[model samples]
Target: MGFDEVIPAPGRAWWSPVDQGAFVLDPGTVLHAGPGTERVAHWLRSTVGAATGLLLAEGRGDHGIELGLDPGLGPEAYRLDVTGQGIRVRGGDPAGVFWGAQTLRQLLGPEAFRRAPVDPGRREWPVPLGTVEDRPRFRWRGLMLDVARHFMPKDGVLRYLDLMAAHKLNVLHLHLTDDQGWRIEIRKYPRLTETGSWRSRTKFGHRASPLWEEKPHGGHYTQDDIREIVAYAAERHITVVPEIDIPGHSQAAIAAYPELGNTDVIDTASLTVWDTWGISPNVLAPTDNTLRFYEGVFEELLELFPSEFVHVGGDECPKEQWRQSPVAQARIKELGLADEDGLQAWFIAHFDKWLSARGRRLIGWDEILEGGLAKGAAVSSWRGYAGGIAAARAGHDVVMCPEQHVYLDHRQAPGEDEPVPIGYVRTLEDVYRFEPVPPELTEPEARHVLGTQANVWTEVMEDPARVDYQVFPRLSAFAEVAWSHLPAPREREFIGFQRRMVAHYARLDALGVAYRPHTGPRPWQRRPGVLGRPLEGPPPNR
Candidate 1:
């Protein structure tokens, strides 16, 4: 038998398999067992029944059934061996089990399992044997959800987690704070939720218009809620990395606590959200009281999240406030800083050290690359690939989430058909063609490329349906890019993957997902019908 014949099994097994009769399965054939053995066994029976007349045994084998687990590896290793009287699976993690199941499905063939060889590779049939080792190239393949702009309910978060788990992604970066809203609840500061959580009026569409509805819009996640979410992710082996934008996108917090602002001026009467984002005069105070306020907030966060990485947003902090404020000027003078950028660096260094002491590594947007890069800081390159390149060259671990390729909020094509302002046009083909690690780096420098991420900024994604529409197919493209390695873009292989996506879309529909339709050419639909039709219109919204 060739490598194409076997299927991998799914789920974690504590006991190592005895090398009596084991064979490597095709990487694509596994099926995830999910959570436990009961579920795994149930899926195995049903899936086998559907594909072949074969049915799995109800319980652990009388012949001392055993499976092994390698936590350091990914889910693709599940392997199943069929011979003489019984079948046995090697490796028991849900992912491993799932992959094994996929191989089994393939072995069962397009017809029912009634045709399955009772003794595969007997005197007449040949069984292929080989050793296989597999692992992910990137450690932090992730997706960032900007829920602060538009709150997604708890159920929505779980659904997103399901997708993340299915794709073998490891991290879910929750953008919890922004100028629009403060999404996480702090018991000490009830006003942060009660007042700053909602806005009286919201800006509708890209065009600035007073088409305002009086409905208040906003919500926050309670500590209990976060605990539930964290546990849910852990079971799926996905880490939930929380991002609290500091110093810069802090208008909502300022609204809740006016004392944190530089000036005593209050803006309670302002009903609309801030139109402009970059540097604002009103930033977090650099005073001892301000530091204490943030420390209390982070203390609460540290308790809720168990992830080793915490994102302290150090992007888009303008130097205008530091230049104007007497206190900021005095701090700069006292600290003997060079300029406002130095002050910004000082703020980040402060948090970087603080987070380090608490057993957490600080991850910042690429802007932290400016002024001075902090030691032991991980960089998320969102502005472009240049930032990621810079970080990698400078000896920092980098997650390549360039707005050009990984920003899921951006439109997939150029047209009025898109949901948000077009920033970068990225088709499915374009996404499939992306390489997270830049070729410019040497082998050692390239090793610094941690992984990649798809960011969904919900500013224009007001509804969950729109959210799904933007995320789906593109996310699938990114999933393969993150998990599987291939030579440069092969149009045929990608098209085959797209055919599989059609089936995936049906599954998503059954699950009540509102994904965007795939209107491009099918993977198998290659005739010399059309060539090079240039896409036109605005870029995608990120």
Candidate 2:
């Protein structure tokens, strides 16, 4: 592989030809980690060492790999120098060291991504002599995984964490709750899992499809599972941002605790965990008891996820129930809220203050901007860039996750063979060319653009393999968009990206990722007849 072949392309890199010789890793080579870099060293030994059949035991030998910290570099910046003498990795911080290690694995070739050495008899692994200096272009390179719609087991979530790290993505926004199911165990609310985690059946494809997966479908992560996930991600320098839908997309929560719903408006007790897709009208009532219950849930959540931002899904919440309920109407009047929109805002603002007081920040979907947002609140602009632009201009931090661009669950191609396609056709190139920070924003406004994230909504993704098919390749491109400082979106060289992908694909293969091939889905990857809701007009730009 050439020195320039790094994905999420490094800031700068150069290499000497093979005629100059290369650094070779064999059973004799050791790993030496300086202060503050023990974690990264351990990871390299456990992951790369196992893959290459090298011991990489702790030592300070002349032919050893050295890990050190350089405070002068950017927090996520790293410098890697590989020569015949040895390999040296220095980072601004532990996270930077870890990222450099990821690049090192890439340099070692695809075989380094495997679980175990492919050829036990072959002992040496050669890394071309080179110098690579790199850092992320954005702080919040993220992937929002919706585990609620089609419950992914604990191991599946862990697997995704590894995948995110592989692409230099640092945030795992775990959408833990939605109308279809709740995937986190709340000890105070045991029924959330017992009653709300499963559905009687699931709509096989799009809601329009006349298909059904006529079997129970649901599972949740126990509190211990959550702790493990958070700890594991922290080891990789990835934060697990847990999302709990509020007001809307919360039928499952209401299903478990009828008292949390607007009981006066509907027999909320009659609601089971929603078995189908789409926003649900059974929203949480705007009552003190409802607030108290979620507060308890958040209290436990905070103990598990120490991430700075808590994502309270404030998008697509239908207000019909709030409009019809006498109790909701009286509460609105009592609070002097002008309308249901104001009530929704009031609910979000309450949590904003609550979370802020506890030294955490609140982040929600763009709808949280409807009435007004607290000064500390951030926005996940999913509808389009308009929300992100508005939020950024208003001095609110923004994560540009506009569905039109980075919705990985959308079909990669317009071909009929694509599996359960949804939304606009966002091919790999579309993602590679996606520009998260809109040019319209002023410099100050653009600073609020925390970064970008690709959201994988699982309405159509039924299993881990399906999730993999939708996320890879495009996610690889998205990673570049998030990490690299490339030319303008239109000017990005897709042809060069395709060339780099030739290597990345082999890495993905070694990692056992079931990604959609560049040539389109393989036979089994296609779902011939399953219907999809494909938009027909020009793709939305805002």
TM-scores for every predicted model: 0.78, 0.98
Query: Candidate 2 has what TM-score?
Result: 0.98
lDDT of 1 by residue, 359-427 (tens): 999999998888887778889998878888888888888999988777777666664446543456888
lDDT of all predictions: 0.66, 0.90
Q: Which parts of model 1 have CA positions greater than 4 angstroms off?
A: 1-58, 62-67, 70-134, 207-210, 264-281, 490-492, 520-542
Global local distance difference test of model 1 = 0.66
Least well predicted 10-residue stretch by lDDT in candidate 1 = 6-15
- How close to the true structure is residue 202 of candidate 2, measured as C-alpha lDDT? 90
* lDDT tens digits, residue span 28-107, model 2: 99999999999999899889988999999999977989999998988889999998889999999999999999999998
Report the number of the highest-lDDT candidate.
2
| TM-score, cand. 1 vs. native | 0.78
Worst 10 residues of 2 by lDDT: 533-542
